[model samples]
Structures are given as C-alpha cells and as structure tokens.
Target chain A: MEPVTTIHGRAYPFGQKNVDTDVIIPSHWLKTITREGLGRGAFETLRADPDNLFDSVEFAGSPILVAGDNFGCGSSREHAAWALLDLGIRAVIAPSFSDIFSGNAFKNGILTVVLPQAAIDRLIEVAQSQPIHIDLDSQTVTTPFQDRFAFDIDPFRKTCLLNGLDEVGLTLAQGDAIGAFEDTVRVERPFLAVGVGS
Target chain B: MATTHPRTLYQKIWDAHVVERRDDGTCLIYIDRHLVHEVTSPQAFEALRLAGRTVRRPDLTLAVPDHNLPTTARRDAAGQRIAIADRESAQQLAALERNAPAFGIRYIGDADAEQGIVHVVGPEQGFSLPGATIVCGDSHTACHGGLGALAFGIGTSEVEHVLATQTLLLKQSKSMEVRVEGDLGPGVTAKDLVLHITGVLGAAGGTGYVIEYTGAAIRALSIEGRLTVSNMAIEHGARAGLIAPDDTTVAYVKGRPYAPKGADWDKAVAWWRSLATDPGAVYDKVVVIDAAAIVPSVTWGTSPEDVVPITGVVPAPDSFADASKRDAAAKSLAYMGLTAGQAMASVEIQNVFIGSCTNSRIEDLRAAAAVLKGRHKAPHVKWAIVVPGSGLVKAMAEAEGLDRVFVDAGFEWREPGCSACLGMNPDKVPAGERCASTSNRNFVGRQGPGARTHLVSPAMAAAAAVAGHLTDVRDMI
Candidate 1:
C-alpha cells in the first residue's frame, strides 16, 4: 500500500449535494461477485446524461474529484469507494462525506478532503479547466487562481494515510501494548484465559 | 488511584462520546443524534426498568412514536390518533411517554413532528458523521454506517451495551472489497443492484467480513440509494458494509443542524479526509462486479438471494442444485405460488405497500406518486398505502401533495412511521394474503406470520398497485 502525502493529479468537478451511491453504482449492479468490471457501471444514471461529469472529455482520466456538500450520503456500500478508485480517482474534495463511506474510502486509499463549500465552489470552477495540487503534509488544495485552502486531519488518521496504514496496521503499531495487555490480563483473570495457539 | 490508561478508539470514542453511563453498561453513548419510533422503544424502555436502569442522558437520545401512529387520523373527527386496534399496546405507549423524561432520553411521542424510524433520523439530522461509531437496537444499525461511522445493528443485549457502556468490544474482521464498476442501464436502481449481488453471492456470501464497496458505479449513487445497497449487507450475512468519504459526503452533512461549524468544521473535514483507505492496500478478499449487466430485480422467496430481474423467469427449484436448496426454493415458490418459467413481473398481488426504512423517503414516495398519479389502484389490489418513514417525511410528503395523490388513486395516505414493516402494530397483511411491499426481510413472519410478502421498489410497488400484480418499474417508466 502506498501512503499518500502530496498529490499532483488532474481534477474533475461535480457540483451537487447529497449525491448518493445509487447514483454512483445503482442497486442493479450488486449481482456479481467480483470488483474488476464495475468501473463501467459507475455513475450509471449520471452517465445517462450526455453532459455528466464523468463523461466529459475535458475531465476524462482525471484522478481527483471536487464535489459539493454531503457527498456519498446513502448506504454503506463499499462499491461507491471502489467505483471512484477504479475510475482513477485517488482523492476527492467535498464539503462533507457519509461516515461509513469515508472509512471504506480510507481503507482503499481514497483521500476525502473536506473543505469549505466556498473552497469547493472555487475548486469546482477551476477543476474543469486546470489541475489542482493537494499536499497532505501541508494539508491544502491550491489552485492556480491564487486560492489556497487549508484543512485539518486527525493525527492518527494522518499518520495512517501518510504510511498507508489500515485498521490492522493501526493495531500492529500498538502490537506490544496489545500483547502485554493480553498477557497481564490473562494472568490476572485466569478464568478468562484461553490458549491462543497462533 | 485508578490508572490513566489509554482507551482504545472503542473506549476513547465511547467514553468521550458518552454523556454518562447509566446502570450497568448502559450509557447514553452521548447520542449526537438519536432516532426512535413507536414500536421498539416501548419494550426497550420497559426493559430498562425491568432491569432497574434509567436513561442516563436524554439529550443524547431522541425518540419518535411511529409504527402505531395512525395514518387515517387525518380523516378522523379530530385528526387525532385513531385508537389502537389493541388497547393493551396503547397502554405500553403511554408508559413510553411517562418514562422518557424520567430517564432523560428525548421522546418525540406520537404527534411529535420529530418521530420516525430510528434508522433514518440520525443521518437526516446530521448527528451521524464520519469516524463516529453508532449503535441502534435495530438490525439496520448498519444503515447509519453510510455516514462513515462504525455503526452496526445490535440485539437487545447490545442496546443495553449502549445504555450502559456506550461502547462495544468488536473483533476486527478481515477486510474485503466488493467493487462495482460500469454504467447501470436506465430503469436500474440501487435496490435492484444489491438484490442482484446477493443473488449471485448467495445469502451468506459475505459471512464474517467487513465489506468495503468501491468502484465508479458505487461512488455515483445518492445517499438513499447507498443505504438501500448496504441495508441488505446483513442479508448476505456480512458484518457491515462501508463506502469512502468524499465531496458528496461532506455536502450532505453541511447545513445540518449539528454539523461542526467554523474552525471546528475545518478540523472535522480534514480528519474525515485522512480516513480513506490506502491505495494498493491489501485486503483478505476482493470481489468486483459488472454494473452494466444489472437489471431491475425482485426477490422470489424468503432469502434475499432468491431474486431475478423483473424481466427474468422464475427459477426452478431444481436450479438450486442441492436438495435442501431445492426444497427451500420449492417451499418458497409454493408459498409464493410461483412456477418455473413464470416471468417475475407477471406475478399478481392482493395489495401493495410503499413505505419502510428501506424505501420510504421523499424520493421514494415521489417515485411512487409519479406512477400513481392519474391512475387508480387496481380493483384486485385491496390495499395500497404510502407510509412515510418519519413524521418529518409525512410533512414534507404532504407539502408536495403526495398524500392527495395516494388518496385519489384509491390508496390510503397513512401517517409517517414503520406502519407495516415489522407488523409490531395493527397495520399488517391479513393471513394468507400476499402483498407487494417495500420493506426489508420477507422471512415467514417478517411482515406478519403467515403474511406473504413480495418486496419491490416504491415505483414498482406503485406500478404493481395499479396493475394489481408484480410488474417491472421500467414498464411504467
């Protein structure tokens, strides 16, 4: 897994609030048992619109997305995260995100940046024409229009993103603590102890 | 002195999250938002006392008395609640109101505009957000995870966990990715897509895994559509389902009453962004799906996997391949009165219902209303009701004249709440009657014991209502 710190990727802008997963990957696509071909189904409904963001030649192949408020608001389907990833989107800029979608996105290395709606509007305006810079170390999304917006990230998640760490990695980082706690707890609460053969 | 030990995210989040832990492990979980309804809370609060515990923090928890709230009240002499068909259950509701304030859990008793399904209210209210862990006694607890929180449905024992500890000790599972890519054709919905996935993966395909749904097709859906997809994860036997945070996510939460504002808002968004999965991150398993092949789907039996698109044929019992599978299939079809080679859309219904946490929002109602407008319910269809998921939904729906649309079509415009989803109240299917519904689960007694259910989307339900049979929503479109 590659840790994301700074990115210089092309950007695509979608200006809408509460864009749901059904719009992204729709319910009909849930039949298959694999993840390889879903990119085609991404934004199936939006794709129906000839002028949809994903279909626009200007933003074709762009890996960064800037969106309006309340993005990814519906179900906890992980496919929403995957569709974006497969479409070559490595990062998303929005005013907000669905809680479960964010976790799923992080696990897949999609950086979801929450900026002010004003910053997002600005980015959306610039994304259609120019590239944007996202610096994880500096925590900003800068456009050529002299606009630089700062954002915040939790230290733990920041560390995880910079190191490509997931839940298991976070646990592993505190491996000694877990091990020591288990050992001591076992000795103290003998009845709770069991053979951990592994 | 007690040691100042580090609380795990489970502990830290739970503790700081808790306004207070009540008797035993029951803490408020500092409900940044609480969604409640008529049926479950009465018993839950009753359990609190039977166990001698009081609600620790009312501000953190909110309640809505739905389920039993009468939809026909508007037609009544006073537009007040129609007396419960069962007086004893009415007594239980009385106790809920009397006890809510004593325990400090906010209760939007019947007639309160705030009441609705506990599952739908949190995200709607902006209380559910990324990185938070939410617990609701309802199996749809997983629904709140749509907001990027570590949310899950818990049993009664687990509800008590929140009532006391405001935290849960969950063993992390091997991560799995279920990716959906491609463009779904017109007439397809998230509901059809999830049902299709479960059909192939089998009902238990996701056993013991935390599924991370990724792909272009998934990221493109609306919040309601995503909920429909993940809501069925439990049907696949997955522990939970999740999506990534992005612009669409943030935009949904902004302007909601409780979302952070100013500098704090900036902090929350930044932290949320960093939580996305790492690129090239390894998972225990990964499953990718073709979005283009999906069609409007419907379930044929009790299990969610027993499904095919509206245009597809009924599956033969033998097609199950195993005797048990075949027998189960046979029994479900026998109960449903379906035959192999029978087109799924041709099935008939005695009634049609369009409401539930699964598909009873403004959009859902609107979709159904669009179809129901300028049409009348089929004579063979005895009942067609549109129940909003919450009181707020009812108001919004009524504001849009959806109620009139239903009434004009020979359908009942019922009050907001889970009227027939679980049959915990009087609104339910009569014995031996088959109805097209828009709720989750079709187990033998899911809607009501011996009450046959055929799940469909709201638009499909509306279409079926007009046709007096199960029909493809696309046909109407």
Candidate 2:
C-alpha cells in the first residue's frame, strides 16, 4: 500500500445514504480474477445516467468523495475499496460508514472520514465547485471556504496509513508468539487442532 | 479483594483467541476456521503467490464454489461435465478449484455432494465450531455465529492476511444484547422476527457492535431458526451475531462430519456450555423486543430496513422523521416502483425465489414445502424456484419428499448455490419483474438489473407464489 498523507482534489458530491457494496461494484463485475480496471464498474448503475456526478466534467477523476450517512453499508467485498481506488478516490467523507467497508478502505489506504451530518451537508454543498483538502496528520477535512471538520480514526490505523505498513510481514515477524499460542492451545483444546495440518 | 470478571459470550471467545495484544488495544486474534468462496478469493490467492507465502494452516481453511455457478445442472444425463456458459464465471470458479488444491486447502468442487453456499456448508460439515473465530470473504459469514462461533466477513486483503497468518489484527467490538422475550405468534418464523428486527434497528444500527441474541423467544427457536437469525447480522450492520451454544447447538453439531468424537465431544460440550454470558455481564447497548409483535414481514423498498408486516401498507417517504431517511425512502420508493398506501398483499410479483444463505436449510425447505404441498403456483407467477443452500440440504429435503412437493406445485427444485439471490447466474429474475424472495438484501439490481425484490420468508414466498402476489403466510396456514 502507498503511504497516504494528504489528499486535495475535486469531490464527487454524491450524498446517497445506505449506498451498499452491491451498488458500489455489483455482483456481475465480481468475475474478474484480478483487481484492475474496476473503476468502470464502480457505481455502474448510477453512472448509467450520462449526467451523473461520477462522469461529470467538473468532478472527473476526483480524488475525494463526499457522501451521505451509512456509506458502503453492505457486503464485505474488497472490490468496493478497489473500485474506489481505481476511480482515483483517495478519501471519502461521510456522516458514517459501515464497519466492514471502513476497515476495507483503511487496509487499501483510502481514508474514511466521519463527521456530523451538519458538517457532511456543508461539505457536499462546498464540494460542488471547490476542491477539498484532507490532512491525515491533522485529522481534518477542509474546504477553501474556511469550512473545516475534524475526524477521529483508530490510532493504529492512522500510523499504518501514514507509514504504509505491511500487516502480513509484521504479523509473520511474531511467529514465535503465534507458535507459543498454538502450543498452549494444542494442550488446552486438542480438538481444535484435530485434522489441521495433517 | 478481587472479584471474578463477568464476561459476555463475545468476550469469552475474544479472550480465548488472542495470540498477542498490542498497547493500542489492537489484538492479533487467531482464526480457527476460514471459509472461502469463488467470488472474492482469486485475488487473495494471487497475493499469496506474489508474497511467496504458503497458507499457515491449510487444514483450517475450506473452499467451495457457489456465487457464480449456474444452479441449472453441472452434468449431462450420461454423466459428463457441462461447461459453464459464462466464460468469466467459469474462469473465476476454475481459479478457486485450482487455488484451493494448490494451496493444500480442502475444496468442495461443483459436482461434490458437499458443495453449497460457504456459510451453509460450514456448519453442516461441523467445520464451524463453538467458541471458534471464523472468517470468510463474504459478509453473511456471520451465519456461523449461529453455532456459537465468533464469525464475521472480511475483505479480500484480510482474506490474504488470514490465509498467510491464520490470525487477524483487530480491536474488540462493543457488545450488545438483542433480547427477544415472549413466544412468537402463530405463522411468525425466525425470518419474520429478523426482518422485524432489521426494521427496528435500521441498516446501520448494529454497526461497530457484536450482538448476542438472547431471551425466551430466541431460546425457543431451533438451530436452523437460530442460523436464519444470525445470518442477517450483517444486514443489521453487525459484523458478527451470536447465540451462545446450548443443548440445541450441541445436538446440531454432534454427528456432523468434523465434530469431535467421544471424550472430545464431552469436553467440547463442557467448554461450550461455559460460553454463555455470565450473570451481571454488562453490554454497551441493549435492545429488548417482544416476539409477539412480529408477523409475516416483507421488505417494501430496496433496503432491508424498508420492511413492514404482511398486513401493512406501503409507507410514504413523508412517514420517515429523519431527513436522510425520508430522502432514502423516496428514492427507494422510486426504484422499487411501489406506490404509497398500496396494500402489501396486493403488490403483484412475477417471480419467487426460495433460497439463499439466509433461509435455505432443510427446515426452511419444509416450511416452504408445507405451504405449497397441495397447491400450485398461480399461472401469472411466471417463474418460481427453490434452490437449496447446499447439495446436502437438497438431499435431505429430497429424503423428506419436499422436492416433490415443490415440483408438484410448479416450482423448480434446483441444485444448491446462491441462485437468484445476487443474480450472478442464469436464475436471475428478469428485469422490470418483482420477486417475492427469501434471500438477504433487497438492494437495487441485486437479483438482476431493474429487478425489484421483496424480501420474505420461505413460507411467505411460497404463499406469494400461490397467490401471484405478496401475501401473509398466516392466511395460507
């Protein structure tokens, strides 16, 4: 994953609430063996309208998306995250997000910023013509109109996004701890280890 | 000077699985079971290949193809493999078929009798165990929590992480108790109860919380009913939902293929019995529900929360107090092509689907079968199909002659897979058609492009098929 520090760009002011993963990429596009080129399928249903914000000249290739509450509410498909990244969405500002979607976004280096609905409403209005700026270090989202909103994120996830940590490598480095846990479990709960690694 | 800590069922499982805890409250938790399906795993395998990481515990992981496979048939009359018509879907399924064996993990193939939806296959095979931490790439993996497992969905990246490390880095979720007391009224099923709960909780109500369902009504439900309720935890925005194991859960797990035997079973049951929440255990949130208030329910809009009792009428957007909810309701009304004030039973449907991870067990099949036993689908109901969750479920249903009941009712008794639920295959409801479906999620275009789905229970779907519209199963019963 690439280190994410700051994102500044036009935002697609799509404020549809309860936007599920089925709408993010849809099941039809899930057939790909790889993650590339999913941008074409991202919000395919909404983009069917040629005048939709995603395809509008003013917001084309925007790095930020301003959305309504409960954004990414269904399905744990990482393709939703990949599709956002493919569409150049580096950060999403919403009143709230589904837990799985937020986690997926964080893992893929996409910032999910939650603010009050009042702030989200203001951002959507300002996002129409202005470029929004987000700074991970400051944990803030700001518009050129002096509108600024602070956000909260998990401290561990914040460090990971800023440093582009490799989670697998980090976990693998603790093989000794993992092995020790497994040894203890082998004795304490032998049934769990049954038929495993045979 | 010290008192013993009272723990929730979730806390018990979480503490048992922690391999390491970080200063920031993030813990590396061991995953005891990993369920894999075709749609979300190809990239995970590729990542493993790129990282040169072999699976940490191949035996703990199980793979099966379901999402994109056609439910029509996989073999000819002469027993030859029939090629999947959709090239992309075939390739995706083939990728899993290759990846699972290559990675030394068990793969239940398309023709295997054990094959079915990953969630259904897990508990049926006893791969999902009590107090185990299970993760799958699909959100409905919460289904395993019905069996007392701490299971939740993961994205593809986490899929790779679990495959390579057999552990997930995570922070513990706030615990919630959804207590449903009193007996469910006649014709009220677990599906109806869950649908009613979704309406009460809204789509994001359980976000960031692991809910433990309890109380009298929940205890009265059978294991299959419990599975139906837990399967929709994701729909309520909870990653995992659990019902602590009791004799019902133990009986369901016993004699299954992977269940421990003899002394191990006795010991496992002892631990499982101890997994229930302790007296005075505190929760971050509590929701008390009256089971008697539930009825045969159906979704009226594109969101699962847009639900109402079968006797109710479609709600106007103005009925919602929240501005965002009002706007969403209006949009959902538009997309669903439903009119406010219309009777829910009067809404005509051209299709009926009686299967999904949400409700496709033998019990579910019998429920639908009982409704359709002496009836046939209405002529105007162009298509009605019952796809079992797994091949085992199908075989079990056939043993009880439920397939004959469905077939005699003019409904197709199809092979098991996630058919018509997400519409990645040929069983999709045609565009512009309304379907009474017993699947999770009524999202736009979920069954197919321009397809409007009204979520209901198996019996309700069967009743709808016979009436050619959405109707209360209570009437039929």
Candidate 3:
C-alpha cells in the first residue's frame, strides 16, 4: 500500500444513495483472477454511457469521487474498491458508506471521506470541472473554487493510511505487547494460550 | 463501589470482546468462524502470500465452491453445452479445486453431498451456532444471526484478517428491535414477510443497527423461515440480524454431523439456551408489523421497497412526494411494460427462478411443488427453472416426487447450484428480460447485466410460472 498523503483531483458527481458493489463490477468481470483487466469494467454501466463521467475529458483521470448517501452497500467484494483504484480513484466523498466497504477501502489505501448530506450535495456541485483538494493532515476536503468540505474519519485508519500500514502492519507494531500477553495468558488460562485466536 | 445499570445486549457483547484498540479507536475483536467461497478467496490468499504469511487457524476457517460451480451432474450437465457458450470460463470450478487445499483450508468442491451455498453449509455443519461471531465473504453472512449469533459479511482484506488472525476490529453497532406480530396467512411465505418489511421501512431503515426480530409471528416461523428473515437484513441496511435461539433451534442442531453428540450435545444445548436475552432486556429501537397484513409480495420498480401486495396495484407517479423517485418509478414501469394503477399481479414475467439462499430449501421446494402439482408452466414464458440449494435438498425433493412435479409442470428441474441468483453460471436472464425471482435482491442488473428482477415469494414465483405473469398465490389456493 502506498502512503497517500495528499490527493489533488477532479470529482465525478454520482448522485445516488446505496450504490451497491454489484453495479461496480458485474459478475461477468469476476470470472478472471487477475486485477489488471477490471479497470475497464469499473462502473462498467456508467462507463458504457457516452455521457458518463469518465467520458468527460476533464474528469477522465480524476482521483476523487462524490457520491450520495449510503455508498458501497451490498456484498463483500473488494473488487469494487479495486476497480475504483485501478481507475485512479484516491478518495471517495460520500455522506456515508457501508461498514465493510469502508474497512476495505482503508485497507486498499483508498481514502473514504464521510461528510454530512449538505456537504455531500455541495461537493457534488463543486466536483464538476473543479479540481478537489484533500489533505489527510487537516482532515479537510476543499475545491479550487473556494468550496471547503470538512469531514470526519477514524483516527486509526488515517494513521494506517498515512503510514501505509494495515492489520498485519498494526500487529507487527504490537509484537512486544502480543508476546507479553501470550506469556501472561499461559499462566492465567493455559488452555487458550497455545491457540489464542484459534 | 456500585456499578452502573446493566448494558444492552449489543453493548454487553461488544464490551466483552475487545482484543485491542489502536490510536484510531479501531478495536480488534476475536472471530470464531471464517467462511469462504470460490468467488473471493483467491485474491485474499494472494494477499497472504505477498505478505509472506500462512493461514493462522486452518480448523477455524472453512471454504465451499458454489458460486460458479455447475448445478448439474458432471456427465449429463457437463461442459459440452456450457463449453459452446461460456467456453473461456468453464474451468472456474477446476481452478477452485486446485487452489483450496494449497491454501490448506477445508474445501467442499463440486457435487460434495454436504456442499451448498456457504451460508447454507455453515449451519448444516454446525459451524454457525449461538453466541459466536462468524465472518464470510458474502453479503448474506447476516443469515447466520438467526441462531442467536453475531455474524455479518466482510471484504477481501477482512477475509484476509480472519485467515491470518481470525479476528476483526469493528466499531460497535446500536441495537434495534423489529417485532412482527400476528399470524401469517395460509399462502404467505417467509420471502413475502421479509420483502414486506423492507417495503414498509424503506431499504435503509435498519441502518447502523443490529435488528433483533421478536414477537409471536417471528417465534412461530421455522428455523429455515427465521434464517430467511435474518438473511435479508443486509437488504434493510442492518449490520446483522438475530433471533434468540430456543427449542426449535436446539432441535435443528441436535443430530447434524458437526453437532455435538450425547453428553456434548447436552452441554451445547445448555450453552445455547443460556445465550438468549433475559426477560425485560432493553432495546434501542423497535418496530411492529402485522403478519396477516403481509401477503405474497413482488417488487414493481428498481428497488426493494418498490413493492406491493400480490393482489394490489402499482403506485402511480403522483403517489410519491419526491419527483425523482416518481420519475424513476415511471421509468421502471415503462421498462416493465406496466401501466400506472395496473394490478401488480397483471404484470407479466418471462422467467421464474426458484433458488438462492433465501428460497432454495426443501420447504421452499415442497411449497412450490404443492402449487405446481397438476398444471404446466404457462407456455408463453421462455423459462421456469427450479434449482435446489444443495445436493441433499435435490435428493430429498426427488425422493418426495417434488422434482417430477416441477419437471412435469414444464419447468426445468435443474441440478443444485447457485444458478441464476447472481447469474454467475449458465442460468441467467437474456438481456432486458424480466424475471420473477425468490432471491433476496431486486436491484437493477442483479439478475444479469440488463436483466430486471422482481423479488417475490416461492409460492408467488410458482403461481407466476403457472400463469405466465405475476399473480397472487391466493388465487390458486
């Protein structure tokens, strides 16, 4: 995972709540095991439209996306996040996101920004043709046209992304603590110490 | 020192289980069961390899190959026909077999008698039970919550989490109580009951909460019916849905292959009984529904909430306050060739599929077969197929002559597989075709790329098969 510090990109304003993963990459694209070919299928239906966001020359390589409430609902397919990343999405601005999808985006180093519905509606307006700026340090999203969209994110996921660390990375960072806990548990509850998580 | 008031069930469960908390407030909670399938495991395994890791607990994790596997027997429904159509992806099943044991996870491959949808296989193998946390790489993981457990789906990285650490750090969820009271009508099924709940409470009604279903109506449903109710909680935006385990639950688990035997079984039963919420357990929210009021249901538009009773009419555009919603409804109605205010039962369907984890059990088959006993499927319809959930279900249906009635009714009695639920296999709707399905979702393109799906009851799907259009099952009854 790359340490994504700053994101400067255009926004694709998709105004729909509860955008499920099934629509992100259909089952047909799931047949292959490789991740390379999926970008072509990212938002495949939206891409199929001649008037789609990707078709607009100005937003073709945009790194930010502005979506409506409840984005990324349904299913546990991380390919939905993978497809967005493959298409160069660095951050997603939505009113809310499905819990599992948010966890997935964080792990894959794709930033998920949650704003109020009003902030989201404003971002949708500013995202068209205007370049959006996202700073992890300030935890704020702003557009070049004087539009500022401040959002909240878990402090933990932010640190992990800033340092490019995931669950494994976090575990290794706690190696000393884990080792100590194992030793203590051996004396406290011998039956569980040998296979703690098992 | 006096402790404060007792915690709610969700809070109590969340508090006792924190493994660790990081700088960002993310807590790593222990996971009990890790379920997987062919569709998502390959990538997670690759991630493990890239990190130079091995599976942490092989016994805790289980895998089944179902999503893209063949429903028919190898020889009769083998690659000959599918090869001509989907030749490139025909070896998807073979790939799963090659990959599973290499990862050292237990794999139940094609035609394994005990194999079915990962969600279905979990309970049958005693992997899903009371007071446990289970994670699967499928949205329907919430289905297992019916057995008084906390279970929900996770993404690929989370899949990797359990594969390596068998734990997930999740934010705690608020609790909600949705109590559906009253008795179900003779023709109503569990599928109808769930669809009706989503209809009244919009799709996102249960957002950010763990919905615990209670009341006489819910308690009366069979373990299978309760499973169906919790299965679609994902459709309602609930993190997980649970029903307290009771005697019915104990009976369902008594003699299964993975269930404990004799003294162990008594111990398991006692533990399961102790897991239920004590009398007067407080809840964060509650909603009551009338079961008798809910008939066989069918969606009329693009979303799950665009539903009406089988005998009711489609809502006119003016019936809604939001213009955009009304416009979307009108567009979906046009695509469905249904007129405003037209009886929803009059809308015709070209396909009727009875499968998916929601309605692919032996009871669902028995219910549908009882309806299709003497009549053939309407000749105008292009397809009507009955795909059983597992081999055992298929064998049972055959033994009871249910398969014959489905076949004799001009419906294709296909093999056991996921079938058209997600349209991963050869079974799917032709582009732009309309289908009446007993599957959980009615989202646009869920059945296929351009296919339209109407979520309905298995009995309603049967009646539609016999009439060639959506109609109330009560009319046949």
Q: After superposition, how far is residue A36 of candidate 1 from its true place, in Å?
A: 54
Stretches of model 1 off by over 4 angstroms after superposition: A1-198, B1-57, B74-82
Tell me the whole-model lDDT of each prediction, alpha carbons only: 0.70, 0.91, 0.78
lDDT of 3 by residue, B421-461 (tens): 88677777877888989888876667877788888878889
Clashing pairs in 2: none
lDDT of 2 by residue, B215-240 (tens): 99999999899999999998999999
Off by over 4 Å in 2: A1-30, A36-165, A195-197, B1-3
* Candidate 2 positional error at B41, Å: 0.7
Per-residue lDDT of model 1, residues B1-477, tens digit only: 232553222233333343334454544333333444444454455445644655433444555555555555623577665666656456556666776666666666676676677666667766667656666656676676555565667543344434433334354555667889997777777777788888877878888776767788888887777777777777777766776667888888787655666665776787667556655556677888899998877888987788788888888888877799989998988777778889877888887888887888777888889988999888989877888877788889899998899999998877667778776677888777888888877777677767888777788888889988788777777
What lDDT would candidate 3 get against the real structure? Answer: 0.78
C-alpha lDDT (0 to 100) for residue A167 of candidate 2? 80
> Which segments of model 3 are wrong by more than 4 Å?
A1-30, A36-106, A109-164, A172-198, B1-16, B21-25, B76-95
Name the TM-score of chain A in model 2.
0.87
Error of 2 at B374 (Å): 1.3
Q: Could you say which candidate leads in DockQ?
A: 2
How is the predicted docking of candidate 1 categorized under the CAPRI scheme?
incorrect
Interface RMSD (C-alpha) of each candidate?
Answer: 19.4, 2.0, 5.5
